[model samples]
Target: MPDLLVEHHGVQVLVCSADGATIATEQDALDHLVGAAFQGAELVAVPAGRFDDRFYDLSSGVAGAILQKLANYRVRLAVVGDISHHMGTGTALRDLVREANRGRDIWFVTDLNELTTRLAPRP
Candidate 1:
């Protein structure tokens, strides 16, 4: 499915529907960041399952690399879906998810609604 453009807190966000695509590598992350920019979107919401399993592995550094790329491009990222399973495996991974969710640049949310709420302008 095609990406849906939505507005939140006056920001344009590209919400990617599950398309059977896996964002497993740095290249995939880069491609999405560029695509988001091309679509005039400041943020991109991707389903968690779209990411490769290695992304949740801290030693693999996949998640960190992808996040770095997004940050470099000044593109916000929202990873939506259930990640409780991945989080259960390690404290490091869980810590990473927690830290990312606490920041504005990257967020790990349970659903699209939560993503939108997190992106909403705060008073």
Candidate 2:
């Protein structure tokens, strides 16, 4: 199925439904952002599998570039699915996820419920 917009926590999110497609480059990331923009989506949800294995390698620069593009476009990004295993690959990647999760612009969540909570209002 193609990307579709869904409301979660009252936020319009464009979900990338392309299963098994590896988003390994900045262009691939940009494509999703563009699709979201076109759909007037305020946020984006992408499955963890959408990202290539290299994205976990901090030195590869894939993750940084993708996240940067999302920020540049003012689009919130949520990487959905369990990435706890990937967290053990290296300190840089683990630190990156930790830092991103601490902010509002981007997040790495284990499931859709966590994604909603992450985007929900905090008091």
Candidate 3:
């Protein structure tokens, strides 16, 4: 089971999972992540260790479901923690994600501070 943490910033973040096991499937992962989002969470931090670039494509139903949920709620999504091991290495995606890291939309961050800073109310 994934542990979801509701923070003072009005964003509920899911960190680590029960049994330290990586979720077995994309379907289950999306269900867990989206459920957490519906819980009044504005942002979600899922470790990259659990999912790969296979999770990045919208063509994948599981990924599509997550993107749809993020768009529907206008919530910012952040997957914190190192994904390099899970994804090997790639600056292109890193740049792509960095560009999307902030806006009125979703963000995939590698650091917790970056996530908190992004979630802050803008003036």
Give candidate 1's TM-score: 0.92
Lowest summed lDDT across 10 adjacent residues in model 2 is found at 29-38
Name the runs in model 3 displaced over 4 angstroms: 8-26, 56-65, 73-75, 85-92
Query: Weakest 10 consecutive residues, lDDT, candidate 1?
Result: 29-38
Write down the TM-score of every candidate.
Answer: 0.92, 0.89, 0.62
Measured over all alpha carbons after superposition, the RMSD of each candidate to the real structure, in angstroms, is 1.3, 1.6, 4.0
* lDDT of candidate 2 over 1-123, digit per residue (tens): 888788877888888885646788888877756555568788888899888988888898888888888788888888888877787866898888889888888888888888877777778
lDDT (tens digit, per residue) of candidate 3 on 1-123: 756676736656655453443533545555666566667666666666655455654344555555665566565666766655533454555554666664546667677787777666778
Q: Evaluated with lDDT, which candidate comes out highest?
A: 1
Residue 66 in candidate 3 has what lDDT?
A: 53
What is the alpha-carbon lDDT for the whole of candidate 3? Answer: 0.59
Query: Which of 1 and 3 is the better model by lDDT?
Result: 1
So what's the TM-score on candidate 2? Answer: 0.89
- lDDT at position 2, candidate 2: 83
